[model samples]
Target: MKQDNEAVGAQEESFSGDESQSLVPDANYQEEFSWFSVILPFLFPALGGLLFGYDIGATSGANISLQSPELSGISWFNLSAVQLGLVVSGSLYGALLGSLLVYPIADFLGTEEEGTYHCSCTIPSWGLITAYAPDLGVLLVGRLLYGLGIGLAMHGAPLYIAETCPSKIRGTLVSLKELFIVLGILLGYFVGSFQINVVGGGYMYGVSAPIALLMGIGMWLLPPSPRWLLLRAVQGKGSIQELKEKASFALSKLRGRPPGDNVSERQIEDTLISLKSSYADQESEGSFLEVFQGPSLKAFIIGGGLVLFQQITGQPSVLYYAGPILQSAGFSAASDATRVSVVIGLFKLLMTWIAVLKVDDLGRRPLLIGGVGGIALSLFLLSAYYKFLGGFPLVAVASLLLYVGCYQISFGPISWLMVSEIFPIRTRGRGISLAVLTNFGSNAIVTFAFYPLKEFLGAENLFLLFGGIALLSLLFVMLLVPETKGLSLEEIESKILK
Candidate 1:
């Protein structure tokens, strides 16, 4: 009884000691600038998504802008569907190559000290990185290379941010990628339409490429993911003090302390050691295939299926071709239709911000089900309007806008947050990459098929197809995916798989 009392006293002392230690200094950033810190990390993930949005939006919009005299001299005008496919899928194909190639580069390019601990294990060693051979005959080789970078950054960035940041801000931060996606779409639509009547030079007239370039360069300024550093150090048993400082900066922000608090040599060593013991074989770790081994398999299915659901809603079809879509419904001219599409993109951006603000309070499953369910109902109504009334194109357009609003509030940003949270640290990068690649592939299929579907089944049936898919996705989310809002990655992994 005396010995038990002594042990209990020691445990109490340790708990009290940590609790008494201030979470922050006198000048706590979290107290004064809490909102900014919450919103800022969210922006980082979106940087890559923004580029993706631009590439997607620009291809169609830029193509339309190129038909005039200013662009008539440019060779891009004579491009065929194969060429168009190259232009459209350039970023996606780059993403695919990057997705496969990142494992090796992330695995072997850097030692355990460079904030890429798992790189030594997760990456495969073939030169599949060059699968995006610049000589693919597209004139936009630079854009393709840029796309490769975007793919790498997009896959790695969110995982890095999600792992490093505290549980308090994780959802908001991951959702930022979604915001950037919407922003990029808006920016692309705006830039592409700016001088639509100006001909060739007009399409190339503005800062789309420059903006993408600037954004890519800007990402370098953000801190390397701390988890990457800890994982790397686990392999070599050597500490990288610089990497530790970066990790400290991130943790400091989360704990409401200074940028370097809890970042001492002892802390670094402890973190690395814990990660090493937890992951067991960092090299044989994080493969897309490995996610199916045990609990990870369930997590993978949830992550991949959620993303697949996000795509099946036909949201991309509405987004990618909103201009022509509105024009088809007899809205003003093509130019006006494009302008309205830009407005819709803006609306998406606005709604996404609302999501960031409220996601934690509202919870993930609720928003997801509500968003998809609402959109499904709206799509069905729009189909009815189109079938019954000749002048119901405006109704269709209004319903589409509402659908974007629903998606923006729910699956648009929530899916990314949920995927980032669900996977454990060991398989995080590969798991999320698989989700992203699945999203892109499904997006590509949906984007390509929508036109053919409309052509074959007519507009009414096309919407019915989307409505049914949305309803099915909603049911799946309710039945399978549990709510993950406000949970830490560790808590989520342990609770979810169990």
Candidate 2:
């Protein structure tokens, strides 16, 4: 009895000691900004975003170069319009397959980290194949392989941003994927403008591969996701001591505390347990059909529909043939039309940067609505200039710039942002893959069928059709697309459920 009393006394003293120490931190403990906390975690994963940007940009120039009639007499194999369309669009569908089919298994088989590395490595190799291919058949095969890499990176990059970033800055980081994409496109144009063959023929394709490989190498230096590390602990995969140490570091990084910061072990342990419980709740609530059953279905509709609308706004058509379209409208000189394309690409870069900064501030739905509405008006003006007035070049040019600006600020970035935000964890991978597939599928249709569309509707009338789609897209945003600004994933899911 005396020994038991002594032990009880020791326990009480230890408890009191812990109570005296502020586990959560003192009121005055200054939390200096840590790169490891905010930037490192978000930045490295976004290397995938950069790779994605490079691939999209590479094709814009390369596909055009490959389709040149002059290439017909070159040492390279002969080309036809049909083969050209296949080369340009073949990658898009390859991307569709990569996203819908590959991501699920890639994600299942390894960590997002491992899956990301796999995608990155393949992208560059595909670029090399396209560069040296002897014939159109081989070239199409290269683009397809390239598309597969693009599909995985496109899907995985944003997903990483969504999963890893803190909510306050999540929009900025995820939307940065779009920013990289635009930047790559702009850079690609620079290289291709002087000599499309110089950049497009072999060198630029080869260059992009090395850059992707570098980013893949960088991926290993960053920490695995805090949530995934915690999940491992819950599943009892690693030794208890090992899991605790790693989890402690991740939790510290997430909370913006330094290694020597005065956080208690108990606090770290509590957070791990809380994560386990939260993950359990997410897993238990959904069955196989649950994604299609309830509010999840609503999320699917909004996400999928948004991408479809984004494409139908004629973004792909304009991008694929900016120079041709401008020339057709009245800028008969190729030099003048190319200048306009340069202006448009630069403008797109600027607006999307604005979006990256203001997305969380302006909110998602407002931008989508405003952007689409502006697109409709701009397209209408362009059509009016072409059809009713017999081509006022100045007015048409201004309208096209306005249309591109609105798109950059609105659908181009926001559509991607929403796809990252809308789905539940269980369906996030598959849901996003489906949305990406829709993105490429629509891109393929617009790109391949544009010639026939122009033949059927005429150029002026085509702008009008695009205008109508933009206006209708505005309605879609208003009716659907819940506001996701500043909400936790759970809170966002709850809104969808309601």
Give lDDT per model, in order: 0.60, 0.65
Q: How far does residue 260 in candidate 1 sit from its true spot (Å)?
A: 7.3
lDDT of each residue in 1-498, candidate 1, tens digit only: 343333322222111112111233453333223555544444544555676676556554654544333544454455454454455555555555566666556644321122221121112110122212223353345444545555566676675555444444445566777877788788877766664555442233234444434443444444454555555555564566666666557445633456665433334445544454454534634555687777678888888888898888887677766666676678645467667778888888899999998888889888888888888987887688668854767786778688989999878888877787677555656677777778777776676566667778987898888899999998889999988766644456567775
Q: lDDT, candidate 2, residue 445?
A: 81
Worst 10 residues of 1 by lDDT: 118-127
Could you say which candidate leads in TM-score?
2
Model 2 local distance difference test score: 0.65
TM-score of each: 0.78, 0.82
What lDDT tens digits, residue by residue, belong to model 2 across residues 329-373?
A: 687654466566667778889999888888888898888888899
Q: What is the C-alpha RMSD of each candidate to the true structure, in Å?
A: 7.2, 7.8
lDDT of 1 at 301: 83
Which is the leading candidate under lDDT? 2
Clashes of 1: 9
TM-score of 2: 0.82
